[model samples]
Target: MANAERRYSKDHEWVRVEGNEAYIGITEFAQDQLGDIVYVELPEVSSSVEKDEVVCAVESVKTAADIISPVSGTVIAINEELADQPEMINEDPYSAWIMQIELSDPTELGELMNAAEYATYCENEE
Candidate 1:
């Protein structure tokens, strides 16, 4: 189930916005598809990313996948714990945020889907 407070992208990335900052991570569906996560390549803290850009990469036992940015912003922080425990994402993708960015354009959020819309989108894909 998608979190009501967060927005989702067609690429299966989720963004939880808090004021000017947005916490970014892959959706539960994404992690499930990837299988057991083995490693995560976290983006640099000060890096700038445009919407749809690859923020980082996640490697699972089955395959490796890029994590796209759902919003344009300067990455301000990352969940360093992922370095040692990448399985945290598979366990709880919502709480295991890969990065937090200072949103460069808040309006870009409008381009993303709400929880319900994303749920429908995922259904269509499946």
Candidate 2:
């Protein structure tokens, strides 16, 4: 696993950049709140995604939620492992990333909060 800086969004998504590509997944806090994950629908490879767009959908036992894109780019790859074992998400959200994207604007990362700020933001959520 590469070193991933936990930058986040108000929508409960996390973005971690490596080189010019970005890896994305929901936080552990989010998966825990959602309960057991049964399926994942990742964005098609090469599809363009805009920031805040619904890039994928995660289906838990109770509900299906969109995994919004935190930064815009072309989706280069997806985690095929999740399709076979969605519980991997429940076990480790960060490791079970939904997709990898080639960011259109790397600077967009500066706009997101760091781990501490994201934790504080989560606490302030309703």
Q: What is the TM-score of each candidate against the true structure?
A: 0.97, 0.93
Among all windows of ten consecutive residues in candidate 2, which has the lowest summed lDDT? 1-10
lDDT of all predictions, in order shown?
A: 0.92, 0.86
Which residue pairs show collisions in model 2? none
**Model 2 misplacement above 4 A:** 1-4
Tens digit of lDDT per residue, candidate 1, span 19-64?
9999989998999889999999999989999988886899998888
Per-residue lDDT of 1-126 in model 2, one digit per residue for the tens?
A: 212377888778888788999889888778988899998987899999999888779999899999888999999999999889999988888888889999999988988888888877777874
Lowest lDDT 10-residue stretch of candidate 1: 61-70
Count of clashes, each model: 0, 0
Question: How does candidate 1 fare on TM-score?
Answer: 0.97
**After superposition, which runs of candidate 1 have C-alpha atoms over 4 Å from their true positions?**
none
RMSD of each: 0.7, 2.3
> Distance from true position, residue 1, model 1, in Å?
2.5
